[model samples]
Target chain A: MNPSLHFRPLRPAVAADGATTLDLLITVRSPEHPPMQLKERPGLNLALVIDRSGSMAGSKLSHARKAARFLAGELTERDRLAIVTFDEEVNVLVPSQPVRDPLLFISAINTIHSGGCTALFDGWLAGATQVANQLDPAGLNRVLLLSDGQANEGLTDAEAIAAKVEGLTQRGISTSAFGLGSGFDEDLMGAMAAAGDGTLAQIESPKQLADLYASELQGLASTVGRKVSIGIRAKHGAELVDLLNDLPLTSAGNHQLPNLRYGQELSVGVRLQLPAWMPNQEIASVRLAWDSPDQEGRKTLIEQLTLPVKPEAELEGLEVDPEVAEQLALLRANRERRLAIEELDRGDLRAAMASIEAIDQRLKGLPQSDAITRERRLLAEKKELMTQDRNLSRKRLRRESLRSSLNVWESGDDNV
Target chain B: MADSLSLSTAASLGSDSLYGLEELLALAGERLGEEVTPRTVRLYATEGLIDRPGKDRRRAVYGQRHLLQLLLIRALARRGLSLTAIAPLVTCSDEELGQQLLQLEEPSPSAEQQEALSYLQSLQGERSLSSSPGSSASLLPLLGSPLSSSSASLSPQRSLSTRSAGRSNVASSRWHRFSLAPGVELHLSESASIPPAGKRREAWLARLLERLREQLESES
Candidate 1:
């Protein structure tokens, strides 16, 4: 029994006669400082995988270099940097060096020139190796790979590269892939990020690359916790239906409990459906269990929480507070709505319009009036954008570009 | 008088005499494959569709007449008319009821009903029953299936008389009227019937009533 144990029950803001019943139990623990005294200045290992193929000679290369310089400036004295530029073959420009030497890093990023076919995989693998070697079990290890063209060289298979990076994620290194221009493989970059336990985003033009990099770097600085896991054991006839932590249900994998460092805070969202009961019958115990590192080498159970279900009518006027659950639901809904809009802009007019309609209806029912208004406006704008044939290319570009930026922001927030 | 006495005695000797109020209500609902709340019992009493026996405030008793009235009320309520609207039609003479119903339906007759009516009228013209006001009776037998016969005698005169009485009572009692949507009129009314099995009877009664109204309107 932790002294800081607090329980919150969630109820819908307004209860209608036929409204669906949603019950949630959220336990907030008092902030506990990590037992171990970790380093105050964490290391940052960034691998800038740039494309130097023949198509990138003019504005593309200029924008790429400028973006690289912007990213270099974001690194602090505690950070380490590496620059890997690729064309037909990969080249290690700066290798793995400390960001303390800003001038050297910027110059190295600027010297890269363009020539032959793009070998995006080679650049990513080279960058991964550099970061993996400099991995401080305590520091944030990341790779930022950018490309203007598709991979057309050795080990060009996107799936194989994603699988390789997925293996790297197991070793605690995360990669963020940025696709530049419309011709590049969006799926390949996205899969790479997914496998690397990071994210993939599309940059329609080189101009947006710097701001994107700066934002990604800022996200790295706010990292509080990583690899967070939550386990729940429901009462008989009850099961955990979903768990969303700022993302939708992508794929189900094995549960991994990672250690939490000092100054890190992680939030987990859970949803459960309990068996229907007769009036006045007590709901059986629902247990929530989680594991985090203690002072010793072994992981300790942080808290085991429980909640009881009572009839909705009887619980009238009692403030139902399921903040975690509500946050999770809101986040999931937002992601789904965003994905639907993306599909719509891709020339799949029917699906896109349908998605907007669903999102519009959902927004109308949301408790947050502000969110509803904002979402409604966005849906309307997207619908208008969909109707104009001339605007198709621009709309597609805008949609992908905005999606990437949003994904980075979300991923950064999740790490916080 | 002797025949009336035997009829009353036989009804009393039947299951009505053996059951308590709660058991009777339960039986009513069970017979109709529904669940009747206490409110439904009160509603039937308020409408005079069910007779409450005596000054025994603690345990009110009801009889077979109550059941019959409930069955009739259920039947009329199913024809897309509100209880208030059905009340007058239920107690009117067949001729009067036919005229009133025809007036109500002519404004916005549904496509299906119009088609059925046209078919029936065309058939009537061939048989030369076209000019008679009483020609509705000819349509009744054609329209009445076995299901409808069990619920209520499709004789328009009987339905009209009952509906007229019900209408006056409804007006005097200030009971609210609930209307059902077009095709759903009969189904919902029967479902919400008071004596429970009233719902099933209501369904059959609805078809017969609809056919009668349609036939009368075509003749007019």
Candidate 2:
């Protein structure tokens, strides 16, 4: 269960003066070729919760059904699948059962049609219950909720629903949200997915839904760690200024992170104000905790980072790490882009442009990579496209920003 | 050409010569024969086919540049030009734009074609109402289809050329001096400006400036 957890301060050393502030990056990397070493991988017990409201009447329903059928075809006989669809009333079309016959699941999925009001929370609860009933400690137990956002029928508040989702995550049944389109409340869906320790996919169309589903299933199959979270324990004199990732924080103050997929790096930026250092004292430590696959308890990895105390003269000569700078730039880009979208919505174009301009300034001297170049292109493209249509622009900006920050960005962009 | 131009278009191109949406539409209707509507004009502006109207005292208004661009787009659309095909025209100079518009007579759209255009327009209206971001329709360059590519052909080089003018050399003659402590002063060039991106960057810059101040104090 050993994974790489690293803490890298931008500057290798800290000045002894209490006035010196340090910026750092925390990275948790998943093993790239783990399934190759293991004899067997855990099967997925997934609950597919779909919204069949009246709003999903025409092409939306047709494409959703097609996506669902395609997903059913992707599952193996080792996996357990349950189909719980909802309108004003929730119905369990396929009970929790083994995928001995993909045909049966697809047939059941095809029979789904549009109905009345959206009972989103109820539908999700029904799906989470299905996974919990046949809970497998060794397997991946998850609820995949596909919705078009409005949950008018029952328990509609986002904060309340996220709380319930986190409760399910605690019981080893994580929930991921697949928001259908522009109508999908990005903040709500993103919040729920973050709380549940799963992926939040902003599906712009029914066609992309199938591909996103396939990728998500691929992620589930190759997940290295589940219930992954980071704990920040600041040493007595040190102060944690800010965490740049827009992550969900637990009541205990741990940052809930996405479940680790092979080759995925979950990195976040932080700034710390350390008091006068004495010798090589450890100022702060970051610990990673995830569900242990080998045993009943949890797996833990600790990385204590302390800068080499040096005089002010020596500290001034040190250069910032490029990796840390890039991460910081990416993090700043994610946050500012979202703020710029909000500024656009408020009809303040200059402020929106300035918000993005700030990010461009931040990227001025950073070493260029595919990642950095991608950030530059995204910032420019979003600024250009943000004025086209308010609803669509806002939706795309939020989703892309969220996706970029989470490192789940795919090149299959629907660029105009 | 000035006499042929719609709405007493003055030869002098001052920035103050502005037109409202209604005025642009009225002028466009005179030139293009009523094919231009407020929605379409706004759509074209948003799609980057025309320069976005600037705000003058809280009311969005367009300049002569926007007027010329709108007329060019309306004429081309009347000539059965697809928006993606016409994207390059956005970068044309005023002389070239006027020349191009003068050569292509507005093809009289047939009743069937008019019906088709209006139907497509109504469909666009409906889709934008229930707009899904990143759809194929969003990718199309023609019409008011959320032309992400329309922006591609229009904005990047245009904004860059203007930006590159100042970016190449940030030189300013004026500088200001402020005292940090006894016998220590800080000087800043006028062009050394930073936008209020966020508090974090500002705080970081302030810290670095603080270091500069300390260094100066130690030197003194």
Candidate 3:
């Protein structure tokens, strides 16, 4: 057997940027010999933040209610859930109620009717507050926010909302943002998710809204893992360049650990190009650390992962293996290409075209077989889309449309 | 009076007095208290079995300790021991070292090691040697047997004369002809061995010698 087989990670390092640093305590057990069972069920605290603005009056509101009903049905009796809705004001439909009566919860969701302007910020703030008040540290604390319209009321500023969400996240309440319509700012949704240390997903059409909600809620109810964070710290003099937690880069920091919700496996991909003088020299070690719920309301650190940065030539020999390098390279290239497109959207067509051409050239150099070839074809299509000189909003939509058409998941081949 | 005169004449004869390969082998054999051959000494020297006295390969002068190690190696080989099995015995000195050596020499229960041992066992059978723990001790008696006795058929005096003739030819060759490439030689010794070949060989040798010189320059 390969010596590396024994080194299988019990708690795998979540990729954060391309420089993954994993920190988790692992309990190793052979698959052939099962160990004594730990806890059979983990306690959960989930808050549903629904948008009841005027825009969610028709099929959007119906989908939200149906989704909530589905979520109510999925929850176990031991799990706790709260329902909160907002128009110009926020309302708590169910105040940290146990999942004891499914019909009653379904009635509560059905009773919600959309009206008034969307106060998304107030809605999230109230839902975050409910979670902060009701969540047990031992249970999976999460705030699932679904919005179909823009934030038009109090504290509508994206940065301020992000700040508030960040506070909620620091308090151990992971928030997942679901945008039900294109009108809702994807950037804002992404920022809020980042602030709350959760994931941002878009349900572009009303038809897919219920299914997305069901899938996300069911995933949450499973609750196999909790308190997941992708911890990353660079070597001396090597500052963290950027970070994206299910969204594009919105904030800058030195060290970061994106908080994660239940069953929300944290995976980060990053890239760092060493100073030219540092060639053939090992930079520093990257470490990742995470904590998971142990019993009732307590959390335990699961693992502390470390990977050394080898010289460019020696990177292939890392114990973590070369797949990590390939993934990092792909992510970096994608990010560069995306940023170039963004620049082009801002009227820098020549620069954007150059970046696109560069990416095309790079793709040509890579192995021409497998899914990468398909990706290159899609990228070429995206470049053609950019050549149309579309407006920023149109360009973004077109780019997203092209990306969705590719049928490739955003993370990388690992998920595929 | 005649014997004394002959001895004086021999002492004055510098041509016969010069040391050669066979003479060197006899000197080594005498120091080791064993019959050593030029081939065995050369093999040991090439394999680094014997440590060179001086830093220079060209100027290296082999002597007693090297001859002793050669004798030990030959004795172990005769007893049907592999180089790997005898390596520890040659290097270790403590009483407990013998147990460690034995453990290393013994085949593990693993299938791979067992297979290797089986192959080695078959080869040992061709020489009619036993695989017993005390088999090495039997080599001493075998050294005095008929097989070894016949090895003395060649006159040692005649061997010495032939070797001396070869040495004279080598000595007369130009020093430049023996010049190794600059960076090719790893040793810092002024008298490093040069290759006896072409311009490409000289270029390669120069590169190695230069590399060695660079290391010395850096250290200084």
Candidate 4:
């Protein structure tokens, strides 16, 4: 199924004699959701990389084990899974195999006990190898690295880890990360997922691990596109100002979008500062590419945005598309949310509050939608939480930040 | 007339935001919550910690920039970082210095704690040892496995709704974060009930001092 893609410029016609800048919103509408898509799922070659460390002694380890067992039970003979657990040492406990018997998977999951220090890099590498070993082109292959971003022993550098994950993603293997509880740096975990073309989530408790796993298993089953990306190249000397997804940019200056879902409405906002161009000129070219989930090979969709340049008077008379305006508001809000979260992390409550209040004040001017209203209300709630308890506020805010930035949650309220 | 606005606000604003030395002292005292004497301000300037205050009509005037720079000098100094170490970090624009002050506020994890938070995360659902069925796949050749393809799942149409997620803050533990490297940290724990910078902060350093204990870890 092909996704419908289009571009909407904030100003349909750029001001030829006025401001030379334009805001373009590229939206890819996925094929509509078919309910029957639930019953049949692509074969999954997945790795569940578990961390059985000393620190994860209580709820963290227990919840993770239960989640692993539950996830193993969910798969069928058609699906293949590999389990790799690590502490000071990395162990491939369950090699990649078909989920034929529940008792065998259960016995393996039950043997997982807390061990020593963290060898995060080596452990993840082990899990990735498992998936890569049993890689199937027609199936979804992923490594769910359960870690807390603490890599003491092996490769502790985040950038290097992210680069490795990205390389593996390019080789048809994706990795997702889940760090149990709050206050842990989601940035590192989130960065890996974003780099690996997968999902990153902050699990609040060991118990939430099972729920998160169930939802993610369902999400994986419904995966329609792998390594979905939007490549926007400038045309006619137009400069790309910003792409507002807060995603890690590729060396070629593009974004790795979340895997496309059935009926995926991927709306990405890009700002373009146009140079002198006549009416009816191509300002930018957008290329959407994804690997077909069921062995259909790599697919690419290209669309050239040819916006008409108008004189200042004509441009002034043009109305902004409501869709473009709405996209601009949400993306702008997302940016402010990031700034606010950064301030909170830096231990500046007043500044964080001030930023949220200032943005909430700014949002009053935009054409308000239910989404914008919720964004303002949520920011206010975060501020309220800060005043009550700084610790709780920080954790809650980080989770909210993850949800907003990634938009990867399968169900339930945004707060979870 | 140009001096009516508060010094720090002026410094954060434009050139029109200048103030007298006394006004700078007062705000610094309030920010640092300690006596910020003119002598100390002058000492900072003499030591080249802050930019030399501008002279408006030969009466030494200061801006918000001077104040932030002053606070940063004191902040870095309080961190026990020598002037040389502080020099490279403080060499930025007023805006960047402001951000740096905010970043410097939080303390880094100590070496021992850093070791604890150092993470090796990957999820393995199976135990291969003493398990014959699952481990047999490890012995199987990779290329020989059948590669059968299937379809993806059906998803519900979704949007960012104002749904309040009810959380269970039970089994709460003091989460620890350790510095793996610069621009990266490993935060273990569900809750980090850190004291507000107010009670323990050095007036101006209050924002950055909250991490002083956290810094106690990484610095150690």
Candidate 5:
């Protein structure tokens, strides 16, 4: 077991007739007694699916090729890599093979040229197939897709694409999408990453592609856990509304948690609806489980808290955890920003402006972090653009929406 | 683009941000992420789910306040609250309204509800509503699908034991074990499981055992 990993629930005892909110802070504190380092890190089964559409003919294609070549250099012989490039038709440039020959891999990637329409769906499917063929049970399995255009050739529907990505996620194949330039569908890529249990990035300019790829690859190489699932067993009549960063969560029986990396703490804020319950009723119990690659075994970390139901009047005096309150405020602000951007996309400038103003007002009273400050500036800039110009750029809207919804600003990296 | 765009400014009201009913509906629809009709907006106004547009019915104009009100109403409506129940709450202070909104946000279902939904979906996919619940062997694949580990699924070496207080609470105590490696193994026990199945006693036993282990170490 990885003793460093810990699950702490910052739950408050609040009495409400309708609902209450809770937060679970998941942290990885280094243990006092560190374990011996293994001789070798866990292997990775990675598929690089690059789009070679005509839209990517110039800088985008070259930058992607450079990134692929650079990624090959970072992987060892133990890692398995598959390179699949797609235009109007999908082609396997290099099948899944051990990364023993970096020269061969780099040469193969360099041969890919931009042309024709984008077969994004088929390209991703082919890459996933390659990863599946060499699927490492104890290693990280991921399909990293880079697209510069929409899915014009096959599977054009965003929901259909997302569902397929989710299917692969269920089958233990994680996927992350990188949208290059303005033409690619940010919504589709965001949906894929969210459902695929991975992260999404918008490479707004071609120049940033290599750096983004490098950062993502670095994170992927350090993956400590796999198949991480958090199943919430809430007491009956108490429903959970949203998860971390205002991510939409349905009132379902079980939830599959996203993978976590070392040295980072992930916090999930759960909004629970409480029907009037009898005093001393058990509110909820959370179960945390994951597969440990280092231990080469399935590991379980459980932290279950039972809250007693209290009368609404009694709960009024109970103060919420200060940290929980702060996190909730940030999440609500982000959600409002997202909604505002969506309104902008729908051509309702007035509502979008209102949402932006609401976000600005909400942010005013919250604890400001670097991420929050950046978001506020971006929102302000966007608001100014909306006020001055009636014509809103789809690219800017898509990028802003993806950035807010995916919690990308929260990360230390300034450019994603 | 004209149909899609809200170009009409509230000229008489002297504020570009202010809007008429047609524009309000469009803005409300966009903010709510759903189609909000003029009639629905009027209904919301009449029921006080949202504030009335202006003092005069002949020349009414809605501004930022009305837009926010309708948006909040739309949000509350999404949370499964009827307009009548949401009306009084809409007029509260911002902080109070926020607190109420957080309170009204739907909670996630319990573990039992998720299992029932999954089971129903599986049955619907197989077109086997009346088919038998199958055996303990069928449960392994579902568990195995998520993890890339070899022994993550239930194997022959795995053992499930239970000690119940009564038929009503069959999962009062349960034990589960699976061999992780040569000498290492995972042992878990929990008091979590759904209620007894109607007729499929065998299936319930299998599912109960699965729940016990899963609950003991819920996935994150």
Candidate 6:
């Protein structure tokens, strides 16, 4: 059986104008009903990439090691694991091998000690290679890189490091990035995950590392869908502007989406400037194809939506659909959150406050009571943190911003 | 204005009749033997899976586009595809859809392909019956109206009455069919509290039909 995947392609029927660009939300959700528990899944080949730089020596390193122990204990004998620690150089403490006795790996992880300058890129590259060497095409192959300092030794640029991760992903190895403490480069970690087709997370404190690592592990082990890709071909006179928030879009084209897990609805908001059209004209065509656990061949589903060209007056009279409005509001809120962070970083407290207020206003207008209410409350708490401590505000913003842009559900809201 | 005038008088103007929501539901039952409700039709419209009624809420009028889309929705839903998957097809122009229909109607058969083609046809026959809520395959042949595959193109200008058979199944077994109005029907299972067939049953059925007609009129 092929992956039970379906596409919910949505766009406003009437655009504001021919020259104007409107947002399109293409969401992919597994068609399978909610199972009682994460069904028995295939094994995972995970490489743990840890930063052993001086900055990570104290609380960060201790928590990371604890997280490693928790991970080692969680895996079954069938799963394969690797541990690579780096500072000025990279060292494979435990090579890629089955988790027959996790204690052996945990003890090796305990022996790791902090050393010289940070070599972030080299560390991730070595870990990604290790995972790829034992790549299980049928199983999940991932590299979880945790860093608490900037790359000072080699390949320091974020784009360069992200490009390397992109190459690794193309070869069937994805890299998830975790930024620990304030010293780490949030931009680099976010870029790695966005380009490598994995989740990006910011650990504000060392204590949260264990829970975050456990959650990431749970997400990896419960994978129900893989190699999910969507291609969009706009008819003549239309341009596919962008997949907003720079989703894990591939260099292959802007069409591909990141892999999906059960209960995760990847919502990609696309902006397009469509040309004038007659009534019932096909504006665009979308093809979604995926490979499931039981499927030997890729299953493809194609859909073409017709957008009729109505007069501006008519469009104005038509009521804006509530769902469309809600999605647009979410996108707007995400944009403002990023803007607020940037303003705060520049020390323009007034500008940051304005952006935060905008997010609050946008969330209030959305229809989903539960989702909107929670988001509004989080925004208020985030504002209080911003004025209280700058470091804490920055950390909170980075974590929330990454999750917001990637559309990752909160801990308890995973199945919802 | 002329288009609206023609649409308002379409009932007497033959094939390209502008159907009310009720008329569309009745036609779905007559042609496909499927019990489609007005609510489902409204849903398809809201989801953009079917052409919406032209006028504002007060005097809404559904045309040939809506009729063609409703039928196509039913046809695609029977193939085990979700509505999200089929929503794109609702955007296809009549000409584009005609081409797809042409492709679906004709198959190139080589010696080796014959076996697979037969299997697919048999699967289609079986699936149309089992998939729908209360529809059955046996009653489809009762339409008896000979329809060519080409005659069923989704062109808005073409009347839907000429649509080819074998697209779906009809209602059967442990079922009761009632005529609530001209071209309108009510399909009920035997479990319904319908009186036995006699003078009391006749009176009960008449009253039931009258009440149904009144309800439909009020909603419209």
lDDT per residue (tens digit) for residues B110-168 in model 2: 44334433433443354333323323222122212212233332222333334323321
- TM (B chain), model 2: 0.41
What fraction of the true interface does each of the listed models get right, in terms of native contacts kept? 0.00, 0.00, 0.00, 0.00, 0.00, 0.00
> TM-score of candidate 6 restricted to chain B?
0.40
The alpha-carbon deviation from the true structure for residue A272 of candidate 5, after best TM-score superposition, in angstroms, is 2.7
Instruction: Return whichever of 2 and 5 wins on TM-score.
Output: 2
lDDT of 5 by residue, A1-416 (tens): 25343444455564546455545544433233224665566788898999986677767788888889988988887888888888755777766667876876787777777655677877887787767766566667789999977776545679977876776665567888888776678778878887776768776666776677667766665566655655666676777655545343323444555555655455555666667665667666666566765565667666555666666777667665656556555556655566776787798989988888887787777667776676677677777778675333344455455442342412234332
Tens digits of per-residue lDDT, candidate 5, B34-92, equal 99888778888787776556533455678665676777777756633345545554775
Best by the lDDT measure:
2
Q: TM-score of each model's B chain?
A: 0.31, 0.41, 0.28, 0.41, 0.38, 0.40
Worst 10 residues of 4 chain A by lDDT: A407-416
Instruction: List TM-scores for all candidates, in order.
Output: 0.51, 0.63, 0.49, 0.62, 0.58, 0.58
Lowest summed lDDT window (length 10), candidate 5 chain A: A407-416
List model 1 lDDT by residue over A380-408, tens digit each: 66666667642433334333333311233
Query: Which of 4 and 5 is the better model by lDDT?
Result: 4
Kindly list the per-residue Cα lDDT of model 2 for residues A1-416, writing each as its tens digit. 36788888889887786566889888888877775457666888898999887667778889989988888888887788888888766777766666766876776777777765667877887677666656677778889999985776545679977876776677677888888867778777877887777877877777798888888888887787888778888895888998887776766778877788778788878889887787778878888988744346778899888778998778878987888888887887777678887888789988987888788777866888888887777677766766665666676667666753343424276643
Error of 1 at B77 (Å): 95
Which residue pairs in candidate 5 collide? A229-B219, A229-B220, A230-B219, A230-B220, A239-B107, A239-B108, A240-B107, A240-B108, A253-B114, A289-B218
TM-score of chain A of each: 0.72, 0.93, 0.71, 0.90, 0.84, 0.85
Compared with the true structure, the alpha-carbon lDDT of candidate 2 equals 0.70
Candidate structures ordered by lDDT, highest first: 2, 4, 6, 5, 1, 3
Q: Which prediction has more favorable lDDT, 5 or 6? A: 6
Scored by Cα lDDT, where does model 1 land? Answer: 0.52
Candidate 3 docking: what grade? Answer: incorrect
Clashing pairs in 6: B136-B170
lDDT of 3 by residue, A207-226 (tens): 66556666665555444333
Cα lDDT of model 4 by residue, A67-173, tens digit = 88999999997887878887756777766667776555677777777765567767887787666656665678889989753765455568877877777777677
